[model samples]
Target chain A: MAQLTYREAIARGIAQEMRRDESVVFLGEDIAAAGGVFKGTVGLLEEFGPVRVRDTPISEQAILGAAMGAAMTGLRPIAEIMFADFFAVCWDIVVNEIAKSRYMTNGQMTFPLVIRSGNGGGLRFGAQHSQSVENWAMMVPGLKVVVPSTPLDVIGLMAASIRDNDPVIFLEEKALYATKGEVPDGDVVDTLGSAKVLRQGSNATLIALGNMVPRAQLAAEELASAGIDCTVVDVRSLVPLDTQTILREVSATGRMFTVEENPRLCGWGGELASIVADEIFYDLDGPIVRITTPHIPLPAADALEDLAIPSVTRIVETVQKSMNS
Target chain B: MSLDVVAPLLLDDKLDLYRSQFALRQFEKRAYDLFLENYVKGTSHLSIGQEAIAAGVARAMRPDDWTFATYRGHAHTLARGVPMAPVFAELMGRANGLMAGKGGSMHLTSVEHGVMGSYAIIGAHLPIACGAAWSAQYRGTDQVAVCFFGDGSTNIGAFHEALNFAAIWKLPVIFFCENNLWMEYTRTTEVTAVANPAADRASAYGLESIIVDGNDADEVYAVTAACVARARAGEGPSMIEAKTYRHGGHSRADPGKYRPDEEVAEWLAKDPIPRYHQRLLAEGASEAQLVEIERAVNEAVDVATEEAKAGAVPGEDLLMKDVWANGGAEWRN
Candidate 1:
């Protein structure tokens, strides 16, 4: 087993795919000669020529459009949008074309393309550069959205997304890019619509996604010391949500709490809560509690920004509140 | 010996290009009649007068090549050999339509025919066409993509994005802009500062481009053929601007009120179908033979309408079926 950081794992996965299939190419703002904005595509241009590893102009719409064009014609293109905040510029292409093409054409077309970008927050990238737009993509019908929390998950999910026939949105948390974890060798093909239970418990289930997964695990560990058995679940994919797994865990524990960094109103947590209420309402022993950022613009101050996202303390408190109810 | 490029189809290649335009003209007339009788629902932008541009450009591409077009896509799809029945059924909102009636007149699609789909969202199809070209070139296929947009689409931000992408990636695509003078009610010159919309923009992207007399099927065929050949050979993308005129209204309901009386008459005289018909006659297509072709066209249109009338309208249950790659919310559970 090799200790690989999330960035290195993604780079290795891309390099492996590019080597195996010549049609696998990449285009982004500084992905080629400059490696990558986050160094996830580092050393790719050196391994593959400039013909395959391209540096595109500062146009998110064009990068996505070109990637889709490449995907439709027989190429497996991996496009980078620099930052998740820039995804707003390319929403029409993402939501309408790439997402809907396969179903619109009666399953005749396969858009095997991966759109990867960093969603910055705790690094203090500010309002323009530090927003998670995955919820917006999850709201769309056709896209398969993924948020990997660890190095191994990044490698495995990136590999699965490259081969999947549907369009995939791979969001890599900017702060977690360098976080190291053991990524085992050999075949790495992770399923898209499955939630991983990080910690098993009997008291309550704490469901989280992307960067919040590690915090939920930490909360569960802290709760374990206090004799509160907390089950932690990581929702790897968002659009075709693994509701069955969520329901199964909730049914066993009889209590549920969702933790997310996104704002409260119309957020991914809201959708998950509604889904649980609609399906597993009778099994719940208490009101499903949600630990999320308040419904306000993300603050710019260092302390305020740190307080805006969900902390392990906040998750533990929310779980305690659910249990007391 | 140097490997010679198969030259673009000339006006002299009457059989290849003429048959296509002829099919388009007949399809439009038939579709118009159906539209009048409430057979095809939704707005139908009939490509009655501007048939040559679509037919000529599509005739230039290979079978495996891809195309994305505007709402006025009958000409493009018909020229690409998508079965006439499915197209008409699609317009009629039948279950047997190209998109299984999910898409109406403005959104006809046939991936098997390499026609990605027709978009009603103005310049929205340009980026999709660019994507298709990228996919084709990535797979190392000789196939190229052709995007057909109206003069109105030139003003959209998507047009700029698509052109820039194609130019930078060196993707195999031919951006065929049919400048039919008017954008619904406004003229092209009124909205655009560029002298020639597609050609002028092509130079900005460092790509080869040319403007042709769109009514002249020969010129349209020649220019499109060259661009298509260049694209297929991996020389990169090119822009072809066909300066033609729309004889009918923008959509099914609107009358041609904005146009001057004399302008309408002038364009009618230079109708693409008749001009090409005269060329066919001069090139030894006998009057008796020409009459036979016309008769066949009229008959084909009649058969299409009959089939469309009998086709089943889509059920309400299917409303949410194709919205997801998997069976959607139902299958997710």
Candidate 2:
């Protein structure tokens, strides 16, 4: 195993895939010389050359449309939309063309493209740059959504997403880029729809997604100190959700609390809560609780932004309330 | 401009282009008839007066060259040698359709025939064609890509982005803008800033641009042939603006009251089919041969319509299939 940061693991995963498959190419704005604004694709242009690692103009629609066309031909293009919030500009191509092409063409074509974007709110980038929109992607039918929390999961899931025979929206938390962890040495591939149980406990099940996993872990640690033991489950893939793992955990611990950084209304957390309520209503000891961002645009102020996003304290408080009820 | 400027055509090639143009006209007329009789469902945008461009462009392209068309693509696909049966079946939503009824009139694709797809959204497929050309260039193949869109598409951001990208990369692509003078109901002049959109924008992207009479099959063929040669020789992308007109409404519902009577009549007089036929007759081809071609086309379209009607409607099971190539195993239990 090698210790690597979240960003390093992502870049290494892409490099490994590019070395494995000649058809794999990376395209985005400033991804080559600048190595991406967040350094998620550093050293790729030097290693793979300009043909493979392209620095495209600031055209998100063309970036995705070209990626779709390239995928239709014979290239596995990993397109990076600078931020998740910018998806609005290219949503028509993503939703109408890329996601619907396979099904619309009756399986005659396969889109092995990955759209990587920086998601979650923590850098005080305000409403435009600091919004998590994984739920918008999860609502699409043919897309696979992945949000990795740790460096190990990021490497494994990024490799799997690139190799998979479908379009995947790989959401990387901007706040977790410098966070370090021990990633396996080589060729680590994770199953798309499987969730990982970071810490097992019996009092209540705390399910988190993307950056919420670390916050949930912290919340679990605090709950453990107070003798309110909780199991922390990282829901890696949102579309092909690990429903079986969630149900199993909920069955073991009669309480459930879901956490996310997106808005509370109609977000992914609501979908999880609905699934748990519908499938395991009889097994639940109390009502399902979701600790998520309020249904308001993220403000630039640090205090307001902190209040708007979900934190460890909020998760712990939600878990305490669910446990007591 | 007089029709005398058109170069003389070989007897066989002239007859072939005439047959293809006639077949497209017959197909669109029959499709509209079927739609009015309630046999065909949904809306269809017919390329009635614009058949010459499709026939000419298809004739100029090699079988290996890729072609992307807009939503008004029946003529484009048919001219590329996709038979009338599957085309009719697709419009009717039958199981034997090109896309097996999933893609209706707006989205038709046949990879084997090099017809990449017919996009419903305007200006969306421009970059897609550039990507295909990029793929060909990256793989070291001499194959080129041709994208067909309306004059209105040139005003969109995708057109600029795709052209600029192709220019910088020197990708082998031809941007064929069938400037039919209107976008839906509005005149192109009212909405667009430039009088000649393709010619005005080509220099901005460092691409060579040409203006051709889209109603003249021979002219369109000649210009597209030159552009194809330039692309194959690695001279980068070119924009060919084929000025034509649509004889019918934007869709089936409109009566075309938006267009002035004089304007419509002026373009109608330039109807490519009869003009080419007159030229053929003047070249000493017998009228009997033209009649025979028309009869053959009519018979073929009749058989295709019958076969399309006889084809099955997709079953309920088809709704759940093909969402993913791996059968969406992760989503299912």
Candidate 3:
């Protein structure tokens, strides 16, 4: 296994898909030549050339529309929204057009496209740029939402998304770009809707996604020091949710906590919590706790932003206090 | 003045264009009757007076060339030679409809017919056309993408974005704007900033200011044909604004009470069907030849209406299919 940062993993994943299929084209603002604003796609344009690795004008609708049109007409395209928050300008294309195309066409036009965007808060890009809006796509019926926390997942889930004959919203956590993880050399393919049990325990089950996954693991480790022994699950794909893994783990632990970067109202966790209550209500020991950011616009100040988003300390305290209660 | 070139169409071509337009007129007329009879459910935006543009543009396009149309797309779909029965069945919401009853009249799509999709959202399909053209460019294919939208869509962000993007990339695509006088209830002239929404804006993107008499199929054909040829030859994108009118209100619900009777009569006088018939007759087409096409089209439309009226509503099993490639809407398994 080779150590790769989350940023490097994005390039590797896209490159792997593009290499595999000539039809797999990547486009976004600053993704080509300039190597993307985040530098995640640093070497793509050099390797794939301008035709395959395009740097579109600052038109989110155009980029996604092009990606959708390409996907429907036989190209497996990977498009980036620069920031996940910018989906506001082009939500019509994302939710209405791209998502509904396959179903509306009755399987005549399939959109095997991956819309990659950097999501969640960390670098104080303010409320407009910092909101974790994967749920925006999740609520839409025809879309597949994927949030990868680590390097390996970035590569694997991206491939799965590209190959999958549907529009996949792949949100890369902005905070996790610099984080490193061991990824196996050669093709690293993984299945969508499958959660990884990074750490196993019996006291409680802590499920997280994107930026919240790393924090959940840290919180789990800290709580273990106090004899809590919580399980950490990276609930990777939100659409095809790994309910079996989460339900089994939650049932075994008899407690559940959701660590989410998005605000509290109608987050993916709420949907999952409702499902857990409906299916595994008898199995639960206590209330399913959702440790999420407050239902407010994310603050910009470094201190306030850190406090607003659920951190390791917050997760640890929330889980510990809930477990004790 | 139109950007009409001197490429004269053959007598057979004029008859074919006449047939295409006559069929569309008959289809829209029938569709309105069905709406009154409560057969076409929900809402529909008919392209009654805009037949010439869709027919002309579709005629100019190669069979493999892609077509992206808007909510007012019944004419465009029919123009691409998608059989009338399925389209009518789709309007009536039947299991054997063009999209199996999933997409209603506004969202008619037939990939096999090269009719990519008819987007309900205004100006949304413009960029999508660019994408299809981009794919063709990437694959080094000679297919051009023709996108149809309304004068109202010119003000939207996607239209400008698509124009600029297509121009820069020089993608084989044509942005066909049907300036049909009104933007729903409001006159398009009042809401729009310039005299010509698409043509005036074309210069901004370094494209030619090409406009045609949208009621004249021959003019629309010549201009769009040149644009298609330009795109196929890798000369970049073209913006063709077809000046036209809508015979009815924006949709089935609206009575079009906003327009004065005289103005409506004036445009109706310029109705593409009669004008094209006159042109075809003037171009050495026999009266018998035109009458035969009219007769054939009327019969086909009546048959389609009957077939559509008899079509069964889609089964419940269809609901659980095609949301994903697995033919299931299962978020979790």
Candidate 4:
């Protein structure tokens, strides 16, 4: 297991899939000759000709709609939207068309396509570029939502997404791209809907996703020093959430704190909190706590942006408060 | 204008082709009557005056080659050899329908017959056809895809994108637009600046375009045969603009009051069915023979209607059935 950055791991996974299947092709705004804005498709055009690594026009609607069409007709197309925020423009193709076609057609078709994009708030990209929108994707029935926090998870989950028969929204946090970890090489495929207990404890449970996973683990370690003994759960797939594992852990701890970078109003953290409260409310010794960004658009200033997102410090404070309460 | 090229499949017998056109016309007319009598569950966009376009293009396509169309698609589906009984049953929303009553009039599909699907969404199936063409070429099949849309579809972005992609990839597809001069209430003249939609746009994509008399089933069949042959021979995509008219409303409710009375009268006078029947008669078909064919089609349609009415409706419990290929959870991870 060699150390690889989350960005590298995603790139490597795409490369492996492209190499294995001739039908696998890549399409996005700058994925081809430019090797993607994030370089996730670096050297892909050279390895596979221009036909396989396709650069498309700026229309996200066209890019996604075409990919859906291609996938329906038997080609496994991996399309990238530059940012999750841009998914708004193509929501018709995503929600009405792609997500419903299989069910509407009575399973006469299968959309084995992967729509990969960067999400989450950080890097001072402002409101348009910086926003976590996995919650919107989770509401859709026929789509699979995958959020990988580490390099290993990115490599494993993306490989799984490409091989998946259904349409998968493989969301990569732009903030976690450069973060490195040991990614297992050669067929790093893992099952979807499985959450990993990064650090196990009994006093409290801290569930997080995407970039927030690392911060949650760090917070748990810090809480351990303060004698809190927190459990950290990485929610890899949001739609098919590992609710059983979460319920068991929450039952044991009787305290929970969920963290997410998206604004608090309709963040993914709220979903987890609601589920915990609804399912195991009687088991809780303390109120279910959540650490989320302020309910507002991400500001351009670094300091304001920092305040807009949940940090390790915020998670620690939220956990401490929940324990004390 | 004819390219004056060598024809891949010669038709020394235009009389046989005219017979197919007559059959299509008769089929649509009887189906419309059944629909009017309320035996058919879904509204059909009958191809009464557009028989030649469907029969001509579909006759040239092989079983392996794919075809797709819009909601106005009885001719396209029937011409592609989707048996008249199942087609009737499908329009009637019967359980034994081609899509098992899941897809009503606007959405007919039969994988076995190579009729990819029919979309109610205008211009949407063009890209889908390109994708199917890509699949065919990838699988090393000489099969091509024929995508049928309307004159109004040319204004949609999907139509342009599909053509550009098909041209760039050199996918074996034929973009056939039935320029019937009307998009429900709007005329083609009000929408596009170009006189000929298909041929005008073909030069933009480096594709060869042919404009044919869509009312002449023989002309449509002859032109489509040459185009499909060229595509199967590895010469990229082509476009065929079949100039025709929908002699009925776009759908069931519309009165089609927008079209000029004189124009409608002119098109109705030269209806494809009678024109083809006259041609067949001129080519030595006896009056009794023509009448016999008409009787056979009417009887077949009647049986189809009776069978469809007798068939059971899909169970309520089966509402969530076939949501996905496997019995996995309806929600994806």
Best by lDDT: 3
TM-scores, one per candidate: 0.94, 0.97, 0.98, 0.90
Query: Residues B262-282, candidate 3, lDDT per residue (tens digit)?
Result: 999999999999998988888
Candidate 3: lDDT of A236? 97
Please give, for residues B1-333, the per-residue lDDT of candidate 4 as tens digits: 443443533333454566566667766776777778886765778787888888878778888888888888877887777777777777776677776677778777776788777788777778778777876776678988999999999888777877887887788899999999998888887778798877798889898667889998777877888788778977888899989998888877776888889999999988888887787777677778778767777677678667766777766645676554463555422
Give Cα-based local distance difference scores for all models.
0.82, 0.89, 0.91, 0.81
- TM-score order of candidates, best first? 3, 2, 1, 4
Off by over 4 Å in 4: A59-62, A263-278, A286-297, B1-44
DockQ of each: 0.48, 0.65, 0.85, 0.43
Q: lDDT by residue for model 2 over B1-333, one digit each (tens)?
A: 123423446888989999999999999999999898887799899999999999999988889889999999999999999999999999999998888898888888888888999998889899889888988887888899999999889888888888888888888999999999988889998988889888777888876657899999989888888778878888888899999999999988887899999999999999999998999899878999999999999999999999999999999877888888685434723
Q: After superposition, how far is residue A178 of candidate 4 from its true place, in Å?
A: 1.0
Best by TM-score: 3
Docking category of candidate 4: acceptable
Over B31-148, each residue of candidate 1 has an lDDT whose tens digit, in order, gives: 8888888887878998888988888777677778888888888888888888788888888888888877777787777777888878777777787788777767766777888899
Chain B TM-score (each prediction, in order): 0.93, 0.96, 0.97, 0.92
